[model samples]
Target: MAIHFFEEDIRSEIQQKRNLKNWIKKVAAGKSFRIGNINYIFCTDEYLLEINKAYLNHDTLTDIITFDQSERFGEIDADIYISAERIRENADILGKTYQEELRRVLIHGILHLCGHRDKSPAEKKSMREEEDKALNLFDSADVPRGTLKK
Candidate 1:
């Protein structure tokens, strides 16, 4: 069970990896799922856009794209790509700090692996509620500040 963070065409890093990993585990456990190898590939909007176009065939910018590769039930094995550029812009627009938006995106991918969908209005509402619960957990936990260099 591991969570790895990497950057592609970006200069950002998750400094509090240990805390973040533990928090992720807790979140998965809450959903009755176990953590497997999860790779978080952070990149620029352009980089993620290329991926979106090549793989998803969508020529639109998105905050995150999750690829689920679980081989068994209750085990998460996936690669999640995030756009740091979008996170920053979203933070400004939503009046949230950069760290807050980043954490939301991070857990949003995990929630997706846990079978949360946001395609419909009801699903989107439920997804947001789940995200809020996870964020509350993060707020009450002993996690440190997230660092992402622009």
Candidate 2:
């Protein structure tokens, strides 16, 4: 499984770590973890706003918007468009580092592609549980408090 970033590079991500790959695999195993390509495109609010309007027909600002392009299971293919600007704001509200929040948003999109939906109350609860599970596994190391950054 490959995790790649397209334009608007996502630097400072933990995905590049060797241990991170193993951690992700362990968390995703027995799930629909595919051995194919998945693209994560990070962009500005304006870029994502255009995509959200043109594709999803929504005007509200969002942190992560995923476009799944797979035809079958075990072929996890998707484009996750993340708005750094939105995530930064969410980091403040959530009282977590931007990195932690970024990790949450990344897992959120992946969980969606894993046949997990966060629509109704029950589904939202389940989704949150899954997110917490993943975070518990991945956030063992202290997540650095993000400094004032633009």
Models, CA RMSD each: 2.5, 4.7
Candidate 1 Cα deviation (angstroms), residue 69:
1.2
Tens-digit per-residue lDDT, 14-132, candidate 2: 34344444445556664747636677777878888889899989998888899988887667778889988778889999898887887788788888888899989999999999998
TM-score of each: 0.92, 0.81
Q: Model 2 RMSD to the real structure?
A: 4.7
| Candidate 1 Cα errors over 4 Å, as ranges | 142-150
Model 2 / residue 142 / CA error / Å? 15
- lDDT of each residue in 1-150, candidate 1, tens digit only: 798899998865455677678788989999999999999999999999999999999999999999999999999999999999999999999999877898899999999999899999999999999999999988884555564333
